[model samples]
Target: MSVQDAFAAPRSAVRDVNGGTGAITDTVINALKKTRPWVLFLAILGFIGAALTLLVGIAVVISSMMMGNLEGMDAEIAPFGSGMMIGVGVLYAVMAVIYFLSALYLLRYAGAIKRLSSSLSVADLEAALEQQASFWKLIGILVLISIVLTVVMLLAGLGGALFMGAAGL
Candidate 1:
């Protein structure tokens, strides 16, 4: 994708959707109605997944604390296990937060669709599309964050490996 497209708000949401007196047209409403069921289902699924993620994070942290005593091991090594587990749990918590927010946006989008279905007005249509746009914008930001984090972690791992090799560890 071009730099402009990459940086731009989700194309699907910002793109001009032609409409009548209201900003959005009938065709947009028709399409939204068609996707309403799927949108609702996805939002519900996201909520469930976010809850599970949070639970897993709590479990990890608790389990790590319980198992952190590397009994009989060197003091230097003992902290590593606990720290890694805690870090992973924290990451999971962060993921859950992002997941929950994304789901909320989706749920709101679905609500907008419902509103449009009932009112069939230009205002309702515009609001519904705005919700949809918000959802996509969040998802795009999350993807970019994930990519950066992955690259950073990879580089850290590589750097550690090189350091170890150089030190003859």
Candidate 2:
């Protein structure tokens, strides 16, 4: 093929490719309709998982307190006290809340999909996608925070190792 032909598609070809926006939209709508049941399942599972996580966190805190009251425990051997356990439990509870919020967003997305199935409007589809975006955005922010925490913890561990080595401990 000549360089000109290779570099550019004919206008007819371009128009043909660009002309199917409506078809594409219809295809997307159909696919979303087909996936409605799965989305509903996901929303239900997410809510259940969030609730379970919150309950587990609360249980951890309560168990830590009960364990603290037990006798014949060496503080040096078991460094975790009720205070530390409470902190850990609180962290778990916070995580549960974040999970629940994200799950709620997923539920919102599912609801939007249901609405779009009935209305078949671009606005409804956009609203559904927006909820999906919100859920992913929250997850992305949490992942970034986790990466920073991991790096900080690694550095702290390295520093401690160096200190201990230098001190001949």
Candidate 3:
């Protein structure tokens, strides 16, 4: 069948590209149904992780403030006194937000898959896949950002080392 015909085909009428008799759509739906529970568990776990990350960020900020107030602290801890710990905490909070968003997408996908399995609504299936795609897209973007940041940090560190070497320090 042509691409248009394939797109127009009903779920019950859909077949494999090899012209098999079985409905490929049904197979995918069944697989999604089987995976729903696992996705739900992952979503719950991710949410818990995000909450813990946020708590850790808060703790770090508070501890940094306390450390700054302490007398006779080493000069090497100047960054914490200068609010660098707050920056680190904010970074952690941003990561937690990303994790929370990923978890939300997973939860939505699981719910949509469950609904589609019961009623076989094409809209519900589409929604489920859309959520799954969104989750992957978010992860892909974060990975790319992380790679770029790592490269930039590596270059900065190399530059610092070169400068320090030239200064005989």
TM-score of 2: 0.77
Assess candidate 3 and give its TM-score to the true structure. Answer: 0.80
- Give one digit per residue, the lDDT tens place, for model 2 in 54-116: 898899899888888878888764447877888888988898888788778878888998988
Query: Runs in model 2 with CA error above 4 Å?
Result: 1-24, 75-79
Model 3 over residues 11-103: C-alpha lDDT tens digits? Answer: 444534334432347677779989999999999999999999999988888887777777787777766464898888888899899889989
Model 1, 130-154: lDDT tens digits are 9989999988988998899999999
How high is the lDDT of residue 46 in model 1? Answer: 88
Candidate 1: pairs in clash: 19-25
How many clashes in candidate 2? 0
Candidate 1 residue 150 C-alpha distance from true site, Å: 1.9
lDDT of every predicted structure (CA atoms): 0.84, 0.79, 0.84
lDDT of 1: 0.84
Worst 10 residues of 3 by lDDT: 15-24
